[model samples]
Target: MIRDLLHNKKRLSLPKGTGILFAMMFLMAPVQIVAQDTPRVTSKIDSTHIRIGEQVQFEISVEADTTTLVVFPEGQTFAPLEMVRASDIDTFRNKDRMNLIRTYALTQFDSGHYTLPRQKIIVNNKELYTDSLQVLVNDIAVDTTTQKMYDIKPLAEVSRNYSDWVRYLIWGIVFLAVAGALIYWFFLRKKPLTQEEKEALLPPFDRALLGLKQLEESRYLIQSQYKEYYSELTNIVRAYLEEEVHISAMESTTEELVAKLEMMQQAGKLNLEKDTITNFKSVLQKADLVKFARSRPDTHGAEEDRKVIENVVVRTKEAIPEPTEEELLQREEYIAEMARKKRKKKRITTIIIAAAVLVVALGGAVTYYGFTKVKDTVFGHPTRELLHGEWVNSEYGYPAIVLETPQVLKRTAIELPESLKQVISTNQTFTYGGLLGDFHISASVTTFREGVEFNMEDAIQGSVKTMEQQGAKNIIVKQDEFTTPSGKKGIKVHGSMDITLPGTEKSEKGEYIILNFNEKGAFQQVIIIHRQDDRYAKDIENRIVNSIDFKNQ
Candidate 1:
């Protein structure tokens, strides 16, 4: 029955498009009652005894739900006691009600006993009263002869210095300019080759001939520079073979090239005479010996080998066929396309690297200022939005319990037995949550006979019974004493319960904390229910409980 009521309430309260979730319920009403027990008001002072002119905090707190408006007794209400300053009204929400507290700093000039008359507060257009409180003001004893006096001292000005950030600003601008220039050069700038630069490009055959002519003009052969001569001689022939025959001749050893040429001849791919092949092998083998073993050759032998290499190159070119017009055109087009792709790939790579570096630098700047906000920006929290959203802090129910929450609790109707209702003068129940949310909270304030004290054991027992009625089973309850910041004591019952909703065999895990505070004839109860596994909801729960204020002096 309770579960069904909660579902109905959530269906009406939640926004459109929200799926049916079985987690929230609220009693909706705006009730105003004017019975003798409607609002419980209390006034207390920080100290009953104080020296003359010494200030004391006088606190008046009223507990009721949002259905009623509570106006505190302000102005010079204390005749003998002078009112110094009235504090801003501090409101607390507890479950379905509000606890409104207003404090006044009072001091008296003359030393004497003072009787604070009962203060009247208007609640929902009805007058409610708090009992008169007492305070004592005594004159402080003064011994003029024993007291020492000190002479006044002159004031001196102190120098102050502030750090300059102009240097950092200038450096930042310089860095940005350099980065921009680099990005432009790598990704955007384009420079075409001049006509002179294009003329510098040489065909493979012409380059090889030019290299041989340069080597012959040098004095390497006459100076017994056999190593240099052999190195240059082999390089020119290897370069010519690679470009014309498409062989990796520059990277191959002499023996490997000879074997490869023999295989190509056997495959009828190339026409090479045995003598020419032998001549090529001899030149390469002699070059390796001179370069690695410091072997020297006579000038006559070097000249003869050079002429033999020249003849070999001429014969090889004669054996090679020239490209047709179509093949030449296709080769030029393929080379141009490849060059374009290389440039495009290089530009894309440069942009990606530059953007990555910029993001890293910006992230560092953000992290240096604030870690939490930056962390949230990168990795968001599940409940951060709700925790930081707008909140309401107000008084609710009789014997008002004050609290603050993300949203206002709605008042719900409660049916009580005739006997229990007679003893319970004012009973207000307010609740929040009945949607697909992680937390649920309820607050209730009940007032009994003015002199009767509420029992802690009975309250805990009543709470356990209520949870059982709501489909809780296998309940494990732990009890502890709690004291609010204002020094009011209460009983806290907390633990886990296995709750199965109506008509469901599967049970969901839930945890709850119930705090019950009673003073005079007023009882304030606050209960929070949350998913056991949600640590974020647990943090919120702790924050709510820690903010409890009883308004005690």
Candidate 2:
């Protein structure tokens, strides 16, 4: 030992404080070695014997002490054989030398001489083994003639007692209340038309008066409660719109209510003419700023606004057209027809929906006794007949297919030649921002022959009309034709184009060219014109054209 110690000086001569560490390490060395070597496994049986169709548990475990630990079962056969579960589990060491085992349980229901192999458990630098257990299974035989199972019958639904008077009494109470309301409305219409009624019928100015009086009483203006001022102004406007146009203005947003009013005006139903609504919208928007924006109106602006409101009230009174005989008759007829149709439709729709419900309910009636036919439709036919795979390829437009197959490579790209520079429409730059760009020109145009082969000439019709309506600057197009440098069989396309390049800088639209197609139209083309600069408009057009493909695929 002295000679060995002299040979290996670092072995026993531990430094200061190292003695205690050495003792502890010595005490734990065997445990650490065992932990490093011996792996753990688990085994259990849910039951010894299960019926023929029943399953039995066969579990094996392996400690995950190594980076690549695995277990394999050998030799032992399966019984009651049906694999139900195979799971991996983990474990930890307890205060004592006991190991909390992780486990995997496998089960089967098939019967016969199935044996499980010995399980091999692998841990760090070691392998462990578990002995396999045997299982026996037997099935019980039954005589068809002597054995039978009785099925329980379902409980019948409890019948509702139509003979009960309580339901009738409740219905009677509802009918009576409704009848009372009808009587009140009928009588109320007759005994009205007093000062209140006269005021209600007045030009809606009285409400403004009342609001002004309320404002005066509350002294809100003196208190500089601008929020209240704007709120009242908005309310007054909403009330006015509701009364004038019969719209639910009070409950709507400024945009929603204004949109409705404008729609009514466009339909020629509202009496207010052009500039009237423009002013109305401005006033409302201003009031909104004061209310929600927490802004206070100066005395002049406030007074001017109040006067404007009064002026609007007066102008609206003037704007309210004196009903011509023809107009009055038309309005009355429209109202009467709408009311009559509404009543008739409600009654008929209610009856139709109720009848449809009854028909659906009758589908479950005993008259549906063709269970064998239904079964054949659902399962028998499919089982008896041959089946082909289902194909769903109706709208297989380029939408589903990708331009490129592999992730690394990109799809085809192009930039249009400067010679093709032109604008289709002179106006609505908002709608056509692609006309201005400076970049190399390379283009690839593929017509999606599979989809509706849109005629390029016809496609411009819609755009032309829209721009015309917007009064966008117009440019003349000189017709030109180009035989596509490439095409597919059947019809070779001799395409034509009409260019409308912008004439002035103010008319910055430089590309309004329409590509007219002949008999042969294929995949949508990539018409990437060289952009003057990197622009979104040109990029969009290029993408749209390239996205279409009409290969035989």
Candidate 2 ranges beyond 4 A from true positions: 1-218, 270-275, 324-553
User: Across residues 273-389, which tens digit of lDDT does each residue of candidate 2 receive?
Assistant: 667667767777888888778777775676566656656665665666578999899989998999999879766765665555445534553258455544443353421121111
Each candidate: what lDDT?
Answer: 0.77, 0.49
The TM-score of predicted model 2 comes to 0.23
User: Looking at model 2, which ten-residue stretch has the lowest summed lDDT?
Assistant: 424-433
- Candidate with top TM-score is 1
lDDT of 1 by residue, 114-183 (tens): 8777888999998988888788889898786898766876434444221223454677788778887887
